[model samples]
Target: MEFQELINSPGLWLASSVMVIAVVIQAFVFLRAALAEARKVGMSRERYIGGLRSAVITAIGPSFSPVIVLLSLIAVIGAPTAWMRLNDIGAARTELAMVSLSSALVHGEVGTASFGVEAFTYALWGMALNNMGWILVSLFCVHRMSKIVERLYAKYNPAWIRLLMSGTIIGLFAYLLSGQITSPMLHGQYGKLCAGFVSAVTMLIITRLLAKYQRMQELALGLAMLAGMLTAQATFG
Candidate 1:
């Protein structure tokens, strides 16, 4: 059998759906728990539901960030494997790299050379092993990390600690944005920089100028991403 046929078989799709189904189930369970807690804390249903709507909208924009690389993954690894790996924790690029590395182990090249069933099987094992490592570490370390955070909060001023934690998240996003915006500049291109700039401006406008519109505020991130992507496409494409 050809590699593509095996990778994208109906059985593979059914198998890959396991992760997607698990994610859906977890989402529903968490949503129910959150609603229960909201009732216990005397939060009105309207307010909590609004927050949920906003969170979902906010998530939609960042989810699109993976689409370009996701297409490449689908092309090289076939849709079912790509679907499963993407639904897992590993980044799309990292998963693609693992496939390449694993295929190399069996002397097969992806999308070019004779990467048959054997190489594909090895690639599956490689991604599974790589993801297992992350799962194991999270299993062992999450509680410890939570405890450390709790102790730090107890030891330090709560306000300052909150700010520090906020700063850490901000720093992480700043690094990610800088990489996207500046990398292309090194190659004399400004598409990513333009997109990032447009997105930031859109966010500021939504938050500051349109503060009275609660719905818009909730959708600020998604709107900003759309505006940025459109702007970049018009300017660069």
Candidate 2:
């Protein structure tokens, strides 16, 4: 569709608005959390901002996490087209149907699909805002963890363990998305179970690996556990 035509489309506008609203809500929650953490830590504004940078990296986990399912659905939708000379066989997967459905339910795909440019634009920016919000929260978590380590430096001989745990948690989350073990979005309790299992397993495996690498990383692992619990809730709860 032409840009003008796309602009005129009601669907597009609706989609964009939904996207904007989702991200804005995420940002508000994140900022509130950040403010609370800042007060708890008694951190200067500069340090808070600096911590935000690190948090951004951590926040990345959730921002793109949902995309794993979204892209899978897109691939699924595009698969038939390719068979009709639209999709490449290299990309086809059974996971698409499940992930798409899950995402549809969570994101209100019906409402979004009805929208066009507006939804798309909002989704784009909402993703950005959401990630930023996530980063802020992650920063607070990381900073708090860092302080814990500093205070108990003598007992925490394996500081590297924390970073490893965090990295592993992030990596495992990536793996579940990559493996597409089961379609989480399909209709039924089984679909939710499958999604929850995959998320839980990923969290456990990553935490275990990090723990083995460093004893001091136990604190971070605890955080990972919290993340895992939250992830499970978000995906299937």
Candidate 3:
């Protein structure tokens, strides 16, 4: 069968949906268990609810970029593959890179007339194999990581530990931002720099102006990201 004919086949959709459903079920189960534990620990209901609200709010901004990437993937791959991968361990950038590499290895390229069933199949396998290492490491090392953190807490001041963690997060973000801001390929593109600067300023403004508003505090990240996106569109789109 032609690759195009198979891209959105019912069989593929069924297989992918099953995995996505399993992930969603697991998430709900974990959430329920967390809420139960929170109640058992004498945590205040309002505080627990507020934490949940904050999590949802903060997740919105980070999720938007991934969703945009997923939409693009749907056009290149298919609905089933894109949905399943993004729903599972697939990161948009990583998945795209893997797919392109797989295609190249097979002497083809995605969206080109030469790319066919064989290339697509190889890309799927590449995505699956590449992600397995990270998944396995996480499964094996998560508990060990928790133990290390516990030991750190026992040995050091909690405030200092928190500062260290915050610094680590800031450093990681700075590293990512620096690549985009300084890349030779992006030297003439002001969109990325403009977006980053707008987002940072918006976040600072929201943090300072909405300091006393708990509900607004939860929404600060999303609002900042929206401001960044709008600025990028106005400047470059």
Please tell me which predicted candidate would have the highest TM-score against the true structure: 1
Off by over 4 Å in 3: 156-159, 184-189, 235-237
Worst 10 residues of 2 by lDDT: 81-90
Q: Each model's C-alpha lDDT?
A: 0.90, 0.50, 0.87
Regions of candidate 1 where Cα sits further than 4 Å from its true position: none
In lDDT terms, which candidate is top? 1
| Angstrom error at residue 173, model 2 | 5.8
Residue-level lDDT of model 2, residues 21-84, one tens digit each, is 6656888899999788897988887666655654665565544444454454433322222122
Instruction: Name the runs in model 2 displaced over 4 angstroms.
Output: 1-8, 57-237
lDDT of 1 at 33: 91
Clashes of 2: 15
For candidate 1, the lDDT comes to 0.90
Return the lDDT, model 2, position 65: 44
The best-first sequence of candidates by lDDT reads 1, 3, 2
lDDT of each residue in 1-237, candidate 3, tens digit only = 667769889999997798789899999999999999999999999889988998898887777668888888888889899989987886788999999999888887877876788788888888989889888999999999999988998999999998988999999998998987777345687887888889999999888977888788788888888999799889887
TM-score on alpha carbons, each prediction: 0.92, 0.28, 0.85
